[model samples]
Target: MLFTSIKPMLVASGDEAFDDDDYLFEPKWDGGRILLHKQGERIEAYTRDGQLVTAKFPELKEVAKSIKAYAVILDCEGIVLRGGRPVFDDFAYRGRISLSAKIKQAVLTHPAVFVAFDILLAEKECWNEPLSERKKRLSAIVDTSSSLMATMSVEGKGTILASLMKERNMEGIVAKRKNSKYIQDTVSPDWLKIKHDKTIDVMILGYREEPFSLIIGLNFRTVKNKPVGLVSDGFSQADKDLILSLSKELHTVKEVKTQWIRPELCCRIDYRDRTDTHQLRMTVFRGLLRDKRSEECVWES
Candidate 1:
């Protein structure tokens, strides 16, 4: 079966974790979500956004040889580990390298490990099967010793695992219902992601008036400061007014309606993680850091 493009099931973000024997908890790997399609010696890999990334990570092509099935589709997270800890930035860096020589060098320098967490299809379609049955089938097909490995999951103890992840400064933990069936292209609550919120101080670079939003940027010394994203949420009227007043004094004309301000004001923002392009995700304006300087807002990770 030639699978051109298939969207994987998505997980909904959860506020807190709970213990449920009917659910399974797995480490939420901070890396790119990929779907691997294997047929005999041939293999193909696609990102969550449907980008053909098989050529990006040449080492993963060997994963096709590890699968016993004649044809199969595996859902996995592509991660690069450093000192036994998953380094998402390294994995993300691998995805961006364009040259073959550069990619090959990166492969040896920062090798990626494919953590197969779900089996969408093996020999035949298995998406309709319950997660428990699918997991069994997945475990039977893939060789655990290979670079393509199965994700370690616990029967219950979501709370415990989440706590451990936080303590270790790992990404977070995912809780999935054992009986839930894989629903393609859907953000299902059956799979919940409890990510540890990361807070960073960013300089307020610009602002918009109509809807009321502030453009934030990371402060780096070597490179030019770039916009991370906008933050309109988690701000009160007073905050907006204070920001607008400050903007009037510091604002410089950049775009027609957009006003660019001096990167003098800094505020703390709570975000999940950086996007593939290094932009902040799930960003919310926490509050102003009155004493902090814009130059003090350096990139965390």
Candidate 2:
């Protein structure tokens, strides 16, 4: 069977990690999701959105030799690790470059490794099979010593694994139902991402006029108050109106379309993690904090 375009099964956000006998837990490696389609000596890599990135990562060509099966489709996360932890920033840099010269240089400096978590197709159709069965087949055929390797999974210890990931400052843990079948392109509840929940108090530096967003910043000892980024998510309609109307009175400066504020108002922001450049990742406004002072929102070293 020939595999054309394949979308990886999506995982839904889980609030907290818990232990369950029916679930298998694994570290949710921070990187881009890639589907490896191997047929004979040829192997093609596709992004989660079904974009072919086979030529971009020349290191993936070595994956063909790692698979023991003649034909298979492997769901994997392509990552660049730093000190044994997957760093998305390095992987993103590796994935974005288009020039052959730059890519060749990056391949040497920031080499990527494919961590296969699930087997979609091996020898025959395995997507319909239970996850536990597929995992067994995946371990049997994949050469872990090579550039590609099977992702390690723990049984009935999600909360324990989540705590370990947090201690290592890693991405998070994923809990998957052992009996679940691979459901492509759909966000399945059978798979859940339990990320490390982190929140920070930031000062509202400014506001964007259209579509409505708050420019937030933290008061660093060196850099007083520098704008980190804009956040629009987790705001209600009333919250939007309150900020837009209040911005006119607190207006300090106007640059382009952004209305700068006095940096008096402070609010809390929920974020997944900080990027390599120190920008917040996956930010959500948790509402205004009236008791806290803007000066108190310091970015601690």
Candidate 3:
């Protein structure tokens, strides 16, 4: 319930309405959107759009067991860290590597780090004081230098922090306002993300609402099967409004009688891998594909 995706805008320097100095800028890791919850070793992972993900990441269960808390909810991005750098595609490859000694060897060789950005619940209590305050509690819990998941935090200079957050081979950065809180509605400029350069075309599977997230189900021309993955980030208010307007003309969120227009709009997403089922793994929406079509895309040669 803590993870949400809206559009991103570059924070301008010296804007009176914005506090550039107070904001925390961190590199956005291109990885699977995950929610970590703990209730006395009863831990599990959930996708950004609220799909259960515990079985997919069995290794994490042990670590999740170590942390003893009544209930702690964290907003984090989970990905395999290879050579101190995160390989965003590992989530897709998990199925292939299941139960393989070599798989754990490789993943441990290049482990996955959990970059937690917010502390929604702490000490069996709601840490809803303020985003700035909640982060302090979250930071105190994870030590990036020694945690199994490569947990990290920025200190001394955030500019330096921003630099460390970068993995030249991975995704981009996500900048957030320290003073912000979890707001259910849009127009909150407290967080923004910048991502990598790989883009792909996809179709709208539908939407999932907690904070009104976009769930992009993947499909390409000439291949007919279940989608590969779901995209949960890189959308803004205008973008959501636009989607709502367009989708309403065809379908309603509550109604299945909707008609989704094909090819009128296309989206370019960034991903690190593909599911055997043909879905985008660890992806985000770059924006609408203004000059492309859904049918024009060919992934299966």
Off by over 4 Å in 3: 1-19, 65-68, 95-112, 124-127, 143-167, 184-187, 196-301
Candidate 2 per-residue lDDT, tens place, 1-301, comes to 3458887799998888899999999999989899999999889988988788888888877888889999999999999888878878689888889999999998888899999999888878899899999999999999975478999999999999999998987879999999999998899999999899667899999988687888899876577778887787999998888777766778898899888889888889888867555577778998988788888998652
Comparing 1 with 3 on lDDT, the higher-scoring candidate is: 1
Say which candidate scores most in TM-score: 1
Point out the worst 10-residue segment of candidate 1 by lDDT. 217-226
Ten residues in sequence with the least summed lDDT for candidate 2? 273-282
Error of 3 at 61 (Å): 2.8
Which runs of model 1 end up more than 4 angstroms from their true locations? 68-70, 82-84, 207-214, 220-223, 231-251, 254-259, 281-293
Name every residue pair that clashes in candidate 1: none
Instruction: Summarize candidate 3's per-residue lDDT along 1-301 as a digit string, tens digits.
Output: 3223322122222211112566666655656656677776677767665676566565665556444445677767776655656665564455345455756575565455566666667774444466668777776654453323323434224445444444355444555666676653344556655444456676564555455654554444444323455566777878877776766554434534333343345577887545445556667677776576555554531
